[model samples]
Target: MLKNIAELNVIVDKYVHWFNHERISLKTKGLSPIAYREQVLGN
Candidate 1:
């Protein structure tokens, strides 16, 4: 378990980055959530 608030924040940040930038789904055409958002929004 994380022993301090800083450690917990670090872990949360890691998971958030992974979820938005590394994780992918078939519905997204194999793109990560961030990538899919950028493509759809034309950013």
Candidate 2:
């Protein structure tokens, strides 16, 4: 149901952001992948 390439890109970007920086994982001890990575690197 995406209307155009731009809309699809926007949806992909949002999903990527959520997957990497927003959604928490129990295996990561309740941290998103990006957060876990930054924590591990002491950033």
Candidate 3:
């Protein structure tokens, strides 16, 4: 469990960054979710 709000925020920030820029999956053809969406949407 998180120790405090600051710690929780750190975890949240890490996940958010990962989700947007780092995390990848085979389903998206090895791209991060946002990147794959942008590619598909032509953003």
Give all TM-scores, in the order shown: 0.88, 0.92, 0.74
* Cα RMSD, each candidate: 0.8, 0.6, 1.7
29 Cα displacement, candidate 2 (Å):
0.6
Clashing pairs in 3: none
Per-residue lDDT over 1-43 for candidate 2, one digit per residue giving the tens place of the 0 to 100 score: 9899999999999999999999999999999999999999999
Candidate 3 residue-wise lDDT, 6-33, digit = tens: 9999999998998888899999999998
Worst 10 residues of 1 by lDDT: 1-10
Candidate 1 root-mean-square deviation in Å: 0.8
lDDT of 2 at 13: 98
lDDT value, candidate 1, whole model:
0.96
- Relative to the true structure, candidate 2 reaches a TM of 0.92
Residue 5 deviation, candidate 2, in Å?
0.6
Position 16, candidate 1: lDDT = 95
Q: Which stretches of candidate 2 lie over 4 Å from their true place?
A: none
Model 3 bad stretches (over 4 Å): none
Using lDDT as the measure, name the better of candidate 2 and candidate 3: 2
